[model samples]
Target: MTSRAVPPATAAVPVQDASLGAAVRLVRVSKTFPIAEGRALTAVDAVDLELAPGSLTALVGPSGSGKSTLLHLVGAIERADSGSLTVDGLDLVTANRRALTGYRRGVGFVFQRFHLLPALTALDNVLAPVLPDRRPGFDRVERARELFDAVGLAGREAALPSRLSGGQQQRVAIARALINRPRLLLADEPTGNLDSRTGRDVLDLLLDLRTRHPMTVVLSTHDPAIADMADHKVTLLDGRLASSSAPSAD
Candidate 1:
């Protein structure tokens, strides 16, 4: 395992023409979890949201405000108990398990903790998504190297998670999320584990990557300053939407 020096910032390459990204629509979506003693707890309650394609939306709320649950519903990790949940015209609630599994592959998820396999090198970690089932016409290794370069780990391909700093680990995680070229990226508290400066750097990296990848990014965060950077803002309270702001014109 090796480490690489941070390269100087370079001009962003020309935006590649790719999929227009996925539009997310939720109509009265509700999700509940079974609790002990024959009881249930509502994680999301009749939440309605419309996220534009290729836009960045911030999910703002405190802990247990349904942010994570809402992301899970969109990612198809969890099903909605009632109401419609659709992404790019596919009905998530009615989709079968197989279909949902396929759907999950196309959607990328980033977590607060950098969930890298400590044993695998950075490049190998990025390649994990495609290892199970290779996609036709996709050069897995080539793509992995390209992503390493894109994420500023160009020379650190063999570096292990234990060798990288927090920021670098998160960058690797971001690269992993983009391995499939997903049209939608779901991030839950992406910056929560890093210090303020590093968190901002990670957030900026996400924004920059969105421009190049043409993907709609939805991230949940507790920091108001971080939320302010998004194109659109959605605030949740007690499993319900408290307010949703229109995308800023700027």
Candidate 2:
């Protein structure tokens, strides 16, 4: 029998407990894309890895190293070509479209570009993700306000993206990512567009948020300094696992 479909964003957002982090497991997973002349480029080669709940992992590599692809795979934006991929026991590789949509709702995503709505206020941007979802018990507005405070943008809620600095915009993006109280958060070069100081500040805020709301965070970055801040570091090269500082899964 098929598993119960996870409620969409229109459903009530569940209040996650402190142990809400999702555990991730991958075994020989691979993803490839077609290229010119009927050729294919392997983005994620056969690889195996595991991330413990509530742990922060850094996917460190140069450009074209598959770090972003791995993040995409985990975020359910791309499907794997072979092998098994599971997060919180949900088999991502094999999940149906509806299931994947529900899974996407549960997984928060932060991007390097800080994908905020140009016309919306910061508070509205944070609330955009769940605006369609009607959850009687949940107060999305209050939660957005709390997140603004958590990200050090409490008073700037009325500001538009154009009025905010890059750092502030990124902060708003971070807050939006957490609107669903996701158990797994994926960040693809989240600090890449900021100045050094602002980047550091964003990273600090992310780590702080992780502590307050327990979740597995997997971020991709080429900067060694950024990778150093993670609990475990995995390096990818030519779509393959080149090295890993993470311990073996028990």
Candidate 3:
């Protein structure tokens, strides 16, 4: 008997855009950290960037190049010491705590390390984002189930992080990131922990998700191949924007 190969499942049809995806704009943005002495270390120098809504952008650079810092600034995880930042017309540099919280609710983050709870099952981990609310009307569990299935972890929801492989664990992380239905996704070296083949698969999954959601994705990576897949590329050097390129139309 001949074995038939099953094609990978595609993401579900996305809902209509509610203006969820946000365009990011940065002007002369800079951030610095104080060092041991009275001196300071600039993580991000004067940099200007513009990201269109619902676009995938790659941030590429070497170590200490400030790629991560730039992502954090956009996600509101880190504040810039100088300059201006605007996302979908909201000024991040001057946003208050309440505004920041609301803005973050519309953003998702995936880290280099799969930040899963060791003791929790895959399903529970995906539900972590909404677990604190304790709202009675929302069906977060159903949403979590759908996300797990979307990431190809349908039957493995009961498995713990310890029992899953590196790639599987990252899938769970991706599912968790989507639990909030975020419009902006920030991924910092998301494929850094997987093997080459597995990393490629993960990247494919990310691209697939982009098609199923109206979201802006900005991922930092050391891989040139990954950068090439993005619609736009931003390269950093010595904490400054070295160059940026947009894909040319055919």
Candidate 4:
């Protein structure tokens, strides 16, 4: 599908007995794809990472450095070829279909391209994720409205993607990602398409959402300035880890 589809919601919404974030860990993870002539291209080399609950980590690297692949592995869009990965104590690498489904429902993803449906309004786009199963008490529409408001798009719910500016469209995308109350958010260069000022605004929105929801966030970026804002910074080179640093008190 060109547009992102919501994962099946067979699992119940996670209870807030604790915080909204989930711990993620990776040990010697790697992924490779077969190319022409039967040779393989390693997208992610054996790498280890650990993300504490409710923390923000920035993945910084150049193009083709495996930043996106790392996020994809954690989001379960792509599987690791070897090693282990766990999120919130669930073994992702060996998770059964049902368990993986449940895990996906608790995670949200945003990309450089605001994958909003051109035909759908902002509110409709936000509500798209919950459309598959409209159980009672879900309040899908109400939650979408609230998210739009939360992202500063309250009065623009009826606006179409074509009618909204780049930043506004990105805001709608952010609202859509939050509709499921995901505990882990994966973003791949979410601000890459925006101007500097607007990118900063979108970055601020993401940081603000982190504080409001206390969810673990991992975003890939090429901008050092943006990476500096994160609580942790991880750099990749040639599908391998170059450096990992704690958050700086700037």
Candidates 3 and 4 compared: the better one by lDDT is 3
**Candidate 3: minimum summed lDDT over ten consecutive residues — where?**
11-20
Q: On residues 152-243, what C-alpha lDDT tens digit does candidate 4 reach at each position?
A: 98889998999999999989998888899999999999999999888888989999988888799999988778888889999999899999
Q: lDDT tens digits, residues 63-85, model 2?
A: 99999999999999999989999
Candidate 1 Cα outliers beyond 4 Å, as residue runs: 1-18, 131-137
Q: What residue runs in model 3 are displaced by over 4 Å at the alpha carbon?
A: 1-20, 131-137
Put down candidate 1 lDDT per residue, 1-250, tens digits, no spaces.
8999987698554342337688889999999999999999999999999887888899998899999999999999899999999898889999999999889999999999989999999998998987465568778888888888887789998999999999999999999999998999999999999998888899999988877888999999988889999989999998999999987544
Higher-lDDT candidate among 1 and 3?
1
Error of 4 at 34 (Å): 0.5
Model 3 residue pairs with clashes: none
lDDT of all predictions: 0.90, 0.90, 0.89, 0.88
Candidate 3 per-residue lDDT over residues 1-250, each given as its tens digit: 9999977697543443436377888999999999997999999999999887787899999999999999999999998988999988888999999999988888899999999999999999998877466778778888888888888889999998999999999999999999998888999999999887898889999999878877889999988888888989999998999999965454
> After aligning candidate 4 to the native by TM-score, how far in Å is the CA of 155 from where it should be?
1.2
Clash pairs of candidate 1?
none
